[model samples]
Target: MPNGRDLGQDRGGDGTAASMIVTTKPPPANSPGKQKTVLLVDDQAFVRQIMWKALSATHAYKVLQAADGMAAINLMRDGGIKLEHAAGTDLMEAAAGAKIDCIVSDINMEPMNGLEFVKTIRVGMASVHRGTPVIMLTAHADKHFLSTAFALDVSGFLVKPVSGTVLVEKIERAIATPVALKSASDYATLIVPDVDTPDLYASVDAENEQSKTVRATDMAEQFSQQRPRFVAISELKVGDRLSEDLLTTEGVLVVPKGTRIAPALISALKDLSEIVKLMDRVSVVNV
Candidate 1:
């Protein structure tokens, strides 16, 4: 089990948070090619060790452990690190090239907290693994915390004292589910072209519920009419907003209309251009 401090309790009737019971069991087996790559991030060494031991019990997974979010980013972005087995043996020297299937991370930590890490990967410029599923582990389940996690588009959330079995189950579910594709309605404008990914667009009603935080002025501005200017993707800047739906030659929706440009998104578009044919220029609002 993953350990954590209960925020609302002093179960011992003393001055300290209650301790958590740690447990471990062998992970379920899977087909040879079904073995997944998992990244576990936590500030505590003991938590990382227990979780790693639980996951590494079988050949069902190739696990990587990091003490904090920064370290986790390094492991995913840079690679070239030595992966060690539970028996103090070198499991693989080429772990740097491995693709991570899912990530389990704690919310609280120093240098880079889980929330910051999630935002960086999901929206940051150098994020190659932006679409990777993430399962957040936290001691607090407050409303604000949950809303932030939802906005970041995390795959799953778990409270502390989570069992290895449940963690494994969540990981499997997250990996099996494709990342939710953003609908044109999710933004201020609808520039949908020909989307062929799937029919699994998120419900507009559900999105509106989560979007309660949008300011009244912002809502008005979205409905406001503005002229559009065609700008080359290479010249797209951080503050520019899309005025039309950005699509690939195959009808895949990339960046939606009215979405603000970011450095990371620009880089991602450039890289995507090599594989798929994106329009030479995008239509942006003429602010």
Candidate 2:
């Protein structure tokens, strides 16, 4: 879900208009030690090189580079790219049959920016690329851009001058997440990187009706207010199921009203006094 209204264009980059440019996710279970490749797109050669090395070193994952949106999309849609080896091997070919596991694009570009790039892959055009998770890299992490990016279904976000540690964390979360093409995790660990944590909740039944809405602002207010207490958010398999288990010291129990909520995000609902009061106000349940 992308909110176009707040996707303000970036002012840097030596080229034209095209380019533009989350949470506690659990450490995906033992991760098969299978590191997926990531595509990094940005105009600056230095940025691309640095990011590629940093991500590769930090995650033991392969990295691809693109100068802008079109290149990134092309590399992603194309079958796959070959990295050198003693046998002159093809990593993506023998492995997953794709060059990239996910995309990390700068939101602002010359003509077709990151947002548009994501739309290109996720939209009606390509079957193989339709579900690739897209992460955003930016220097302008203003309130609007942050909220707007996620609205468009952006998987991850990082401010400019990111550290290797943070970049690895963000990339892992995105690649491990599901897209139209596939789901990222098979274990509960992927959903909540740090286990045994609690997040707060407030009622928002009115917005649940728009579960499929890709528009950013559509759920901005509610999502923003809840993030403070939302210690973590895992992707739920089903949507519109509100059933949840309140994390209390007294052995946990399930609340059956989750039909309207996404199971992955249910852990975000904590039972703090204020959170309980908020849920009560909205009549979402105080579980």
**lDDT tens string, model 2, 23-117?**
01112456456666676777666566567656544446655556677755554455444444223332333223554677788766645566556
* TM-score, per-candidate, Cα-based: 0.52, 0.50
What's the lDDT for all of these models? 0.57, 0.45
lDDT of 1: 0.57
Residue lDDT tens for model 1, 26-137: 2354445666888777777667666666666655776666666776676566665554333334343344467778888887765666766776666543234666778877
Query: Which residue pairs show collisions in model 1?
Result: 1-23, 80-96, 125-264
What C-alpha root-mean-square deviation, in Å, does candidate 2 show against the real structure?
14.0
lDDT for position 174 in model 2: 67
- Give the number of the best model, judged by lDDT: 1
